[model samples]
Target: MPIIKSKIFTKSKKTSSFFITILFILSFLLVFINKADLYIGSKIKTVSADIASPIIYFLTFPFDKSISAIQNLNSLKNISIENNKLKEEIKILKQWQSLSLKLINENKAYKELLNVNDDTFETLETARVINKAPNIFANIIQLNIGLNKNIEINSGVLNERGLIGRIINIGNVTSRVLLITDINSSIPVKTLNQDINAIISGQSDSILLKLKFIKENKMPKIGEIIVTSGNADIFPPNIAVGKIYKIEDNIYYVKPFVNFKELEFVNVITKKL
Candidate 1:
């Protein structure tokens, strides 16, 4: 019994030492990894994402369908209320529509007289939002369409409400969208009534975006509609972005039309190159 116990103790000690040695080596390797700029973590993340993306898509498919169905039902429920509001709006819009048509015809006549010709075309592509970043600091979403669908970088993304954001990164079957609420985002905008031009810049944690490049004397009024001016042609002209939310101490802020958290689908406008 004593010899048996001695042999067992020897084996146990060797096993424990073996594990301890392994743990020490692993600790050193991890410390070295943390200190060195080997970029191994980046590579690992890329590989893991590539392997896990399809699995995630399949897992979330049913949930997405359910959400879409619920949205449709809610929309149906609100249709009557919206219809009543639209009826009143349409009555006012018809008068403007008639004037707009008359003005368009007059403008065409003037352009013809001046021998000026302008022709431009735009195409829109649809993409599904597959993933949304839960981090408040990073206001971004991932789309299911990418290079396969010819989705170009920096293409304007929007829903029915108005301009949302632009494409930032593209992968094989996915793309990342930097929302208008992201700190890195900026857009050229103009107020509808005053025609006061300014740049809209995003905030880190706030949904109300900042208005820049506006003169203090030309502050846009509250409730004024803001739209893309296409100053640099980054986005198409006259795309409704949002409304002026507040003006205080020579500062202007806008409330976005599209709720960033609730986005499911978007239209990517691909301009002709």
Candidate 2:
């Protein structure tokens, strides 16, 4: 055992001594090179840079690429957040624009209603249309005002355009208005251009009104306006009703000035119950 230990120690000492001698020789050469030339120092620096450049690039290339990728991802995240905020702002602006349009239309309708200045009505009440649905009554509409507002039966109903319908049933808070388009509705009317009197009756399952009992001697022309004659004292005189658009087979179809689909507010102006 001791013999093997001594052999290992001798080999280690020889290896150490050889490295020390080589280092002493290199140190002496370094001093000689220092005195060699200023240009030699520059050449050594150039060679050292050539060798170290590739090693430095190899070490830093992956790190630089990783940093660039991370920066790009952060920029994309910021762009996404900004886009979401812009979308939300646009949505809110659109909602306000829609509401503004609705108000403008409603205001225009109200102005049209104000133009219906009737001087013959003893009682005038503004009513809101609550329901207009299809039923056994072909063209029936319900109003918000009824007996509570002293709304009378057989009273006249009109919109901004002209006379639309009449009141039939009166409740405490609501009333059933029989639209002029109903099959049973018949109004005594006279032509605007001529004094030809006739009964404007509603046709079954149709929106147009029919003129009946016109005197053979007085034939009215197309485009003549029709107004109430106040014969039965139900609808007042000179109240606008409809226009004669077409006349076929001795039957004249009158297109009412009131648009049933857009009838939102109305005026009930006549005698009360």
Q: Model 2 segments beyond 4 Å from truth?
A: 1-91, 111-115, 134-138, 271-273
Candidate with maximal TM-score: 2
lDDT of each: 0.80, 0.85
Taking all chains together, each candidate's TM-score versus the true structure is: 0.53, 0.65
lDDT of 2 by residue, 1-273 (tens): 999999999999999999999999999998887788667888899999999999999999999999999999999999999999999999999999989987887777777676667566543678888997854335888999888898889989997788988999999999998889888898899998787899998875777899895587888888999998878889888889999989999888899888877778888877323
Q: Specify the poorest-scoring 10-residue window by lDDT in model 1.
A: 112-121
Candidate 1 C-alpha lDDT tens digits along 112-179: 32442113215456666789778645588898988898888888887767788889999988998888
What is the lDDT, from 0 to 100, of the residue 10 in candidate 1?
Answer: 100
TM for candidate 2 is 0.65
